[model samples]
Target: MTEVRVGDLAQGFLFRRQAVQLRTELSARGQELSTGRAADLTDRLSGDTARLAALDREVALAATLRRNQAQAANRSAAMQAALGRVQSATEPLATTLRSAAAGGLAGELAAAGSAARGAFEDTVGALNQSTAGRSLFAGAATTGPALAGADAMLDTLRAEIGAETEAAGVAQIVEDWFAPGGGFDSSGYLGADSPASPVPLGGGDQAALDIRADAPALRQVLAASALATLAADAALNLPEDTVRALFDTAAEGLGSAGPQLIGLRADLGAEEARIERAGARIEASAGGARRARASLIEVDGYEAATRMEALSQKLESLYAVTARLSRLTLLETIR
Candidate 1:
C-alpha cells in the first residue's frame, strides 16, 4: 500500500470531529444513567412509533378516567350520606304519625305535627347539601339548591290544597302536586328535569351519578310530610274524627314512604359499588399502560451503566488523541 499523509489542518479537523462525537455519546450515556430512560424515544421506537403513541394515549385517557371516577365516587358517597340523614329525619316523624293514628290526644297529635315540620326542614336541608360546592341532588343543576326553601315549599302545598274540606281532597291535591311531572316540578324542586350524564370510567364502562329532589321516593316522603303540616293546621277547624282520619292517612302514607326511601338508598348503594369496581379496573389498566410505555422508552440500569463506562473510556481516549495531535505541530514533525 502507498504511504498516505494527512496535513496538519486535516488532522486537527479529524481530531476535533472525533472529540465532538465522543462527547455527544458521553452526554447521551450520562442522561440515560441519570434518568434510567432512553434519551430519545423516537430512536428507541426504531421507526415504529405507532404502538408507543397508542400506549401513551391510553395512559393519558386512563388518567382522565381515574379523575372522573374519583369525582363520581365522592359525590355518590355524599348523596348516600344525605339520604341517610333524610331517612333518619323521616323515620321519627313516621313513628310519631303512627302514634297519632293510634288515637293520640290532640296535644300528642299537635306534638307529632311539630315533629313532622322539623323532619321536613331537616329533609330539605339534606336534599340541598353540597359536595365540593356542587349540589348533591340538583341533577344537572349542580350549582344551586335542589329544592326550594322549606317555607316556600310548604306555602306552595298549602296554596295547592286551598279550601279542600276533607282528607281525600287534601291527599289528591298533594299527589297532583308532588307526583312526577306535577306542581312540585314548578314549585318545590328547583333542580333540572334531566339528570346529569353518567360518569365514564375507562374500558367503555360508566357509572350513574344521578340524584334529584323530585325523585319518586323523595316526593313520597315530602308529600307525606306536607300533608302532616296541613293536618296540624286543620286540626283546629276540623272535627276530631276528621282530624283522626287525616292523621291515619298521613301515617299510612309515611309507612309506604319509608320503603320508597329505602329503595332509593339501595339504588344509590349499588351505584357506589359499581363506581368502586370501575375505579379498580381503571387503575389496573392505567398501570399496564404505564409499564408498556416504560418498556418502550426506559433503559435497563445495568446495561446503561455498562454503556456509560464504555463511553467514558472512549471519550478519555479521544481527548488524549486530540491533545497529542495539538502538541505535534509541523515544526515538531520536521524536527
Candidate 2:
C-alpha cells in the first residue's frame, strides 16, 4: 500500500488555497445572483459573441434611430405650428382685403394693406422659426434662417415692379419673381432647393422634413402679401381702381393659398403619424433584442443562489479544518 503524507504546514496551506478558490467562486456566484448577470460572460455565451454582439448593435441602432425620429418629429411639429401661424397671418388679411375691395373704400383698403405689410413680416418670422437650433422650414439648410427679411424681399419686389401702376402687370411681375428659378429663389429664400434627406426611424421606416420657404403655397401667400403692401404704398400714388384691383388680386391669392397650406400641414401630420408608428416599432424591436441578449448573458438567479450557498458551506468547512489544524497541540495530536 502506498501512503501519501502531507506535513501540517503544507496541509494547512492546501486548505487555505482551497478556501481562497471557494471564496472567489462564492463571490462570483453571489454577484450573479444579485445582479442577474453572468460573472463569466465568456462561458455564458459559449465563447461565440457574434449573436450577442449583433443584439447589442441592434439596441444601439434602435436608440440612434429613435433619437433621429424624435428630432424629425420635432421638426415636423414646428413646421406645422409655423404653417398655422402663416395661415393665421393670411386669413385675416383675406377677409379684410375682400371687404375693402367690395366696398371700394380706398382709405380702408390702404389701412388693410398697411396691416398686411406687418402680417407679411410676421409671416416671414414664422417661416424662419427654428427648433432645436435648426431651421424648421429651411429644408437641408438647418443652420440658417429659411427666408430673407420681409424688408429685403419687399425692396426686391419694388425694384422689379418699378412704378408699375397697373394691377395686372404688378401681379404678373410678382408671380414671375416668386416663381422657380426666379428672384425669390436667388435672394428671398436662403434655404436649400433640394429637400432634406429622410430620417431613418428603424424597421425600414423613414420620415422627411422637406417643406421649404420657397414652396409654391408660401410663394402665393408672399406674392399676395406683396400686392397688399404695394396697395398701401402712398409712395406709388396709385388710382383707386388700381388699388382695388390689387386688393382683389391679393384677396383672391390669399383665399386660394389657405387650402394649399392646409394640404401641406396635412402631409406633415401624416409624416408625424408615420414617425410615431416607427417609434413604436423600434421600441418593440429593441425590447425583444434586449431580452434576447439577456437570455444569453443573464444568470439564472435561482441556480446561482443555490451554487453560492453550496460554495459558502464548502468554504466554511475549509475554514473549520484550517482552524482545527491551527489549534492542534501535542496532547490533542496524541489523542
Expressed as tens digits, the lDDT of each residue in 252-335 for candidate 1 is: 777888888898889999999999999989999999999998989899989988988998898788788778866676678798
| Candidate 2 per-residue C-alpha lDDT over 15-124 given as tens digits, one digit per residue, 9 for 90 to 100 | 87898899889989988988999999888778998998999999899889879978987888888899999998888998888888887566697788888898799889
Model 2 regions lying over 4 Å from their true place = 1-6, 104-107, 300-303
Q: CA shift at 155, candidate 1, in angstroms? A: 1.8
Question: RMSD to native for every prediction?
Answer: 3.9, 3.1
Local distance difference test, candidate 2: 0.86
TM-score list, all predictions: 0.87, 0.92
Task: Return the top candidate by lDDT.
Answer: 2
lDDT of each: 0.84, 0.86
Consecutive 10-residue window with the lowest summed lDDT within model 2: 1-10
RMSD score of candidate 1 (Å): 3.9
- Residue 147 accuracy (lDDT) in model 2: 94
Candidate 2 residue 98 C-alpha distance from true site, Å: 0.6
Best candidate, TM-score: 2
